[model samples]
Target: MQRDQGVPQPRLLHIEADYSPAVSKTEPWVDLRSIRIDEYLQARSLAVKTQKAYRQDLQHFLRWTDKAWSAVTARQIAQFKTHLVRKEEGQRVLSDATVKRILGTMKAFYGWLWRCGYVDRDPTIEVQLPKLAEPEADNLSDEQVEKILAAVAGTKLCDRNLALFAVLQHGIRAEAATLLNVGDFDGQRLWVRQDKGGSKGVVPLDEEGVQKIQAYLGWRMSQGEVLLPESPLFVSASRRNRGARIGYDTIDKLVCQLRDITGIDFHAHQFRHTYATNLVLDGMNPYHVMTLTRHKSVQSFRRYTKAADQQAAEAAFYETKRRKRKTEPGSEQ
Candidate 1:
């Protein structure tokens, strides 16, 4: 028998043959100690959460390779992708989406390395990511959305929750919502700050949303919190932290509370889905919907369109059945 090199032996969780290129782990590898990964991360100006995630992802690769960024080859990157997708010790590991994210980060890191002259060549150039399944578009019905709004409307801290729901309904990100200041709203339009492309844009609020926001502002004044242009639109009500900008955790907790009260397992993103679906259902062009949602790509907004199409198809089918039943001689009620 030919003495086996350190070829990855077949395991219980068979990796697809396509990604399993013939490679040896014992091949010459360099440690990543010298790579200026921190400098790279900071240079990108990533959001705090995103920076943390990228660090974690890069750490996973470093630990796996035990090699310097310069010593890493495309083969190893491909192998790493395989390792991430396969089951580790009888347990399924990362999902395809996670694997894709990891690879994307690595590609960016290595590309940066090459640009900065840290490496002669980028190793992650040709690594193919697993196809990501189209995200399922889950949106609550208009009635369900109204019920959620009503559940928090006019209740204690109603101002806060009302603003939260309205912002979510308008499809603003939770982080963006948390950063909103009193001056961002002008009775009719809400200026969404720190949007994805690092620019501010205005979204028109309906009269009802504006009225509720004004009511909430009035309530804040009643409690002696002065409403200044620079004041945070949403603030903590506790005496200790009064007038302090509300953090994302507080917004998330509020969403969870409403979810518990309504028995609806929905989050802020679902509100965005609901907004998009409602627009599609109301015969608004998806292009226009994407414009309102500030989606950079049509592909991002197409999920809502697909969901709306399915709902419309089901409604038409049921309506046809109902009409057929009514036409039958003995089916009339």
Candidate 2:
């Protein structure tokens, strides 16, 4: 598969199987005696994570039915959903979104099985997915962002913190930022590899960005350590002695700390929103912003470009008008 700059493509699995005998069955119900998940995933070209999730969901459904999938009816699927709502432990009932995901997985698996001739019928065909409630968009204000940055300033982990800030301010995704390594950065531009969907992209380093990074690199070099080309740019201090890259969990914790310090109840994704919102507020076109963010769809980008504060919007509007008025001959004092 062709990859764009800075975007990581989903892993592809080639499927090779012949199910002609199974597809020829005209029976309403076919036996699922030896349907292995690994074989199913291999046949469907599904990602490994997706394969695991679907198999787990299928296992739960099978355990509930206490019979082979060929013997399970649509009614049993409904019963399993009810069981998930009532008898499940941990946080009580599962959220509608979670339940819908499980249902989707089941539907896809059954549909594939039926299509492949492993099953004569898809029992989950009529199962309706639950309605999902849209979540309110969470974002940080400029003041909040400033506070978070200030809190990180003069800290022992200043370099890593600044790198994280650069990602947030520049609207880069956490995954993309995490994949950054020492060699990807030249003096002029930062080469982001396989960021989203295996797309490679380049981010030009502005003067400020360059200076900040240079300062960090100078400090790093003073320690007389040689960083490998494949080594992570932002490594964990705890594992510095061991020369290990920082994991996703550490990044998540740092985000939470920033949120607490700034008193902003937001996730790491909110930084992307904050960046996009600021750009739109500055009169940048949505399409151009999408290019910088590398969003595949406009609708997805729109969600992040939410309206800024009413006061800030009005203030900016008046400020632009004031500047325009000053440029006019009669309007100038």
* Top candidate, metric TM-score: 1
Best prediction by lDDT: 1
Q: In candidate 1, what residue range of length 10 has the lowest lDDT sum?
A: 27-36
Per-residue lDDT value at 33 in model 2: 42
RMSD of 1: 18.8
Model 2, C-alpha of 122: deviation from truth (Å)? 3.3
- Model 1, residue 257: distance off in Å is 1.8
Displacement of residue 137 (Cα, Å) in model 1 is 1.5
Expressed as tens digits, the lDDT of each residue in 184-226 for candidate 2 is 8786677877565444677665676776776766667777868
Runs with alpha carbons beyond 4 Å of true place in candidate 2: 1-63, 69-72, 85-92, 111-117, 187-191, 194-207, 239-241, 297-299, 306-333
TM-score of each: 0.80, 0.66
